[model samples]
Target: MRTGERRPTLADVAAEAGVSVALVSIVMREAPGASAATRQRVLEVARRLDYQPDSRARLLRSGESRLLGVVFSVRHPFHDDLLTGLYDAADKQGYELTLSAVTPRRDERTAIAGLLQDRCAALILLGPLAPTAELATLADRLPVVVMTRAVRHRAVDVVRTDDSRGLQLAVDHLVELGHRRIAHVDGARWVASADRRQGYRDAMRRHGLEEFVRIIPGGSGEEDGARAARLLLDDPPTAVAVFNDLAATGLLDVLRRHNLDVPGDISVVGYDDSSFSALAHIDLTTVAQDIDTMATLAVSRAVERVAGAQVVHRETVIAPRMVIRGTTGPPR
Candidate 1:
């Protein structure tokens, strides 16, 4: 090869290995027809020539992308965990993943459009905020699976945690700890916000603590939690059930800044049980969503749809568990 030579191709690899291009293709795809010694020799020559198979060209030839597009929010820690699980699940099913993040500058619509442009075989949305009508329209274009949100759409399959049960567990834990004045920091516009908020109300009523039910305006971010914490300080509750772990951590920081002792002056319970919640210093008592199970189910459903399986468009809800840690105790 000369200086600054063109990148090696499959033909170059075949010529160097004294094999036909057809054999080279078989070796590149790891197809079963090639003998073991011949496959190894071809692979060795390809490696020596720095030859790489063009995945895009192969996908185009097969008319199947085998791509599972994932849309996730960059700000959510739970989304990061879910992404890792999704990758493992997708790989098990012989599919590759293309991720589009919903950042502060990029909205969900833009991220989804980019995935569509990439010709993803199917989409797995992580806690999408798009309207039901919009999702149905997108589903018409390609198979869509919604994760971490419960919605009934004729064209969409859903895989989500039992959010109502999750919040119920949080309130139940606080009630068991003898905390009567329990408030909720709500994720006002989040995907699971309404369900969790209603669950908080229902759980309070179930325990005959409806009279003490309070909900502060919040969302799925630290700033929202900080704002809710300020409101709580005006008339603090003995314990608070936060929207999610990210918001809970913010509230925890604010409470610390105000010299309020957690699980002493005011106990705290968060939802989602994200990675940050398990930190030694955080140790947030929260509701745990089964991320691995949800991810696996989501990928399976998406792959089934992509493969033209005759499956019903149904919602698969997994139960949430309660994790007790340093954050919650009996109310002062």
Candidate 2:
């Protein structure tokens, strides 16, 4: 070696540690087969030589891209909050998340297949629209954790709210306020929406007040709520339980335009206690879902699959609490 020149190599580290070049190579690249003592010795020798492994080579050998694929349906603002929770949890668990939105143009199957080709360990689908049979088929190859959807497949884990109970809470609140002539603004197309709508109907029947209930043609947004409100201009109910906070905001807007008093001349309830639900001006009564817990549990379940654990077909249903605000009162 020249006195003024210096270049580090695996052979140099092997000579310094009294080990073979093969052993030094394993330690330098952090391969799985090295013994702890041998690894420590090789690491010490490399530190003396100031050796750094090639990151590109390391990634190729590990077969891990260190990325988790996350798919969202419709990209609602509430989903943005859930994404924040998911990202924070993923970071703490030492995984990076790649996001893709499923739209009318880009279908779910194509987007998910692209993610799999990129070597993502698992896929998290939020409020998926795919058929249950299709999801079960996908689970045969890779790990799948669904948020806001239910499945009984052995390969899928579900984290969701008790949609039935949430709706019952809404109905019970209005019923307690003497609201017999109540109505429901339903988001009927989604799976969760169907459950909530059924729960509303079931609760109404239990209270023997089904005769007075009205079913409004609505959806999951403020525009749908506004349209439903317009339809109610001629024959308004004493109170209404909207599909979500966005719809409730729209209902409030239409009611304000028509000079109807909230919870006085009419009461209103909404689901999903989103940030917009608590504005100083809005002050909406809503059902609160634990976003942080759901996100954390979802990631943990994904990790269990990645670890080769014998996971069961698990479905978790967390009950929602009703957040009573100024939007509800005794029916007039």
Q: Who wins the TM-score comparison? A: 1
All candidates: TM-score: 0.91, 0.80
lDDT of each: 0.92, 0.84
Tens-place lDDT digits, model 1, residues 1-332? 56889989889998999999999999999888889999999999988888878886688689889889999999999999999899999999988899999999999999999999989999999999999999999999999999999878768999999899999999999999999999999999888999999999999999999899999999999989988999999788999999999999889999999999998999999988898889999999999999899999999999999888977648999999999999999876
Give each prediction's root-mean-square deviation over alpha carbons: 2.8, 7.5
* Residue 262 displacement (Å), model 2: 1.6
Model 2 per-residue lDDT tens digits across residues 172-272 = 99999888888999986865888888889998999999897688988877898999999988999998998888888999999989999997888999988
- Stretches of candidate 2 off by over 4 Å are 1-61
